[model samples]
Target: MTITSSPWVHPEPSQSQLHLDVVPENVLHALAAGESASFVPRFVSPYLAGPECLSLWRMRSGQIVDTPTDAPWITRLMVDPRVTAPVGVAGFHGAPDDTGMVEVGYRVDPLLRRRGYARRSLETLLAVAQGHPDVRTVRASISPENTASRALVSSYGFVETGEQWDEEDGLEIIFEVSAG
Candidate 1:
């Protein structure tokens, strides 16, 4: 949703608390390099180095090359404030398009799934989108086989508009809802 704001805020500490620590270029590089333990952001848990997260870092590190350092809002660790450790990753696909459409992506560690972290991550992204002036619509392109994710989006009032074939993720159901 083109969250132009800096220092993205996290929810206040509570049992359900989750925060995002922007994964900087160097950290992305190190994660992409497969050395999660030695990464610059020592507070980031190694769970963030999961295969999915590794791919995200590899791709995002390349994305920041010619872009503004703070512009992408690309990837952040979905952290558990109680222990200050990451349990997942969440961020927009990119800035909003001409139609004010922006897509959201989030992946919680497989081992840590079903603890409501995914829901919290989606809530955070939706809050960001709703507050951004440029965002009119938020999108979630989910794999049809992913019932949990499908249910998640639907519960947020997103309606399925159609479907698309993705080279990497195969067929996906596209859901959209007004950002506000």
Candidate 2:
């Protein structure tokens, strides 16, 4: 799938050369409506608005409705400029809470897995958290079966704190790291 080239938004560059462009609400609404073309032409993968990403667009749309300020924190498209296509998605669940903690989530296209996209996404989130005055902690709840995710977080000094049963994700092992 191809997407016409367009300028990337966020100026914060990453080691992976992946730009985590915040997915705008208009685009989210269009993708939720099953029309990827409803969005401005961006250098992104067709998968961003495909059926595979429907639930994400839908969920984030609803989230923006209730917490408009969380828009920027909630979702981003992980795009590789060299390829001018999205490799995956990433960002926090929402703004930092009262405890100064923000939960992170990301996913790489199955075909693009193990290419360091996920790592770059997590690193970006960590860097954001570290730099934001309101953020003091970064959290990730990964499934125990997802050893790769666990290892990734561990390499970054995240500590296993506990586990929880998620309605949609089943059991997940919780990990956290100081954003400082």
Provide the RMSD of all predictions against the true structure, rounded to 1 decimal: 2.7, 5.5
Encode model 1's per-residue lDDT on 35-139: one tens digit a residue: 777653334565677665677777777777756543456777776755546777888877778998889999887778998888888887888888888889999
Alpha-carbon deviation at 26 in model 1, angstroms: 0.7
Q: Which residue runs of candidate 2 sit more than 4 Å off their true CA positions? A: 1-14, 37-46
lDDT of 2 by residue, 1-180 (tens): 111123233335534567678776777777777777645546346767667778888888899898887887877888777765677788889888999899999988778899888887887778777877888899999999999999999999999999999987899999999999
Clashes of 2: 0
Give the clashing residue pairs of candidate 2, or none. none
Where does candidate 1 have its weakest 10-residue lDDT segment? Answer: 4-13
| Model 1 local distance difference test score | 0.77
Residue 59 C-alpha lDDT in model 2: 87
Please name the candidate that would achieve the greatest lDDT relative to the true structure: 2
Candidate 2: C-alpha RMSD to true structure equals 5.5
Cα error of candidate 2 at position 159, Å: 1.0
